[model samples]
Target: MSFLHSLGLFATLGLIYGCSTTSSLTSAQQRDAYLQQFIGQTSQSIQARLDLNSIGYQQVLAPVANDQTLTYTVIRPVTIPVPIAQNPADIDAGNIPIPVTPRAQSYDVNLQCKIIFRLENNMAKSVYYTGRTC
Candidate 1:
């Protein structure tokens, strides 16, 4: 009975330990490695090019990202809802009603992976994403 209890406790502790390390890049070396891997990624798993007017990642996490290692991620594709003309374009010419504004549909840009970064201090330091503009 005593031996079984000890084994169970050990297993529980081991599971907890494993979970803690999942996102805990605990050292600068680890952060650097992670940033390198992060930047090397060719694409994002959820990339939707912002409208030239639309805001990029910076506006979202300003001051904090400037000082410490920052990481942002999305699990799936970032979909932009393009209001497509759901109405049929090929309606008969003679009886066609006046065309209203075209409705848009959603299309997604699939990014191959997630984006992460490591910053040194309060500035948009270039830890990654040099080849491509964020």
Candidate 2:
């Protein structure tokens, strides 16, 4: 029986970072008005608080749960754009009529998570021992 030899897990994670909403009117006339509605001006990058650590097992597969409850989830990132055309029929061999396909821009961001673990075999009882994954 080995669940860290006794079974005990505790975790805490919640750190938000880098946020914005729109506040760039030349510093918005020296901040005022409720701090400019909580202020906002970003470089794009929001995510702070994700500490995952769980490692302790020694043959625990029969039924052991002093308080079975485990869950994890968080994912955000999406951007798609790619187009480069030159002399192929700028909508029919350009003629100063319609030939303007030159635009470049890029934004990349990604973060994802999905985990669910809940076990309870008659409240919990089973152990074996060997660990790695935190």
Strongest candidate by lDDT: 1
- Each prediction's TM-score versus the true structure: 0.24, 0.23
* After superposition, candidate 1 runs with Cα above 4 Å error: 1-58, 63-68, 71-93, 103-116, 120-134
Candidate 2: residue 83 Cα off by (Å): 3.3
lDDT of 1: 0.37
What CA root-mean-square deviation does each model show from the true structure? 19.8, 22.6
| Model 1, span 1-134: residue lDDT tens | 47567656655564455444333445325534444543422223112221211222222322223244444532223443432232355465444655444332333443332244554433224454321223
- Can you give the lDDT of residue 84 in candidate 1? 25
Q: Local distance difference test, per candidate?
A: 0.37, 0.27
Give the worst 10-residue stretch by lDDT in candidate 2. 10-19
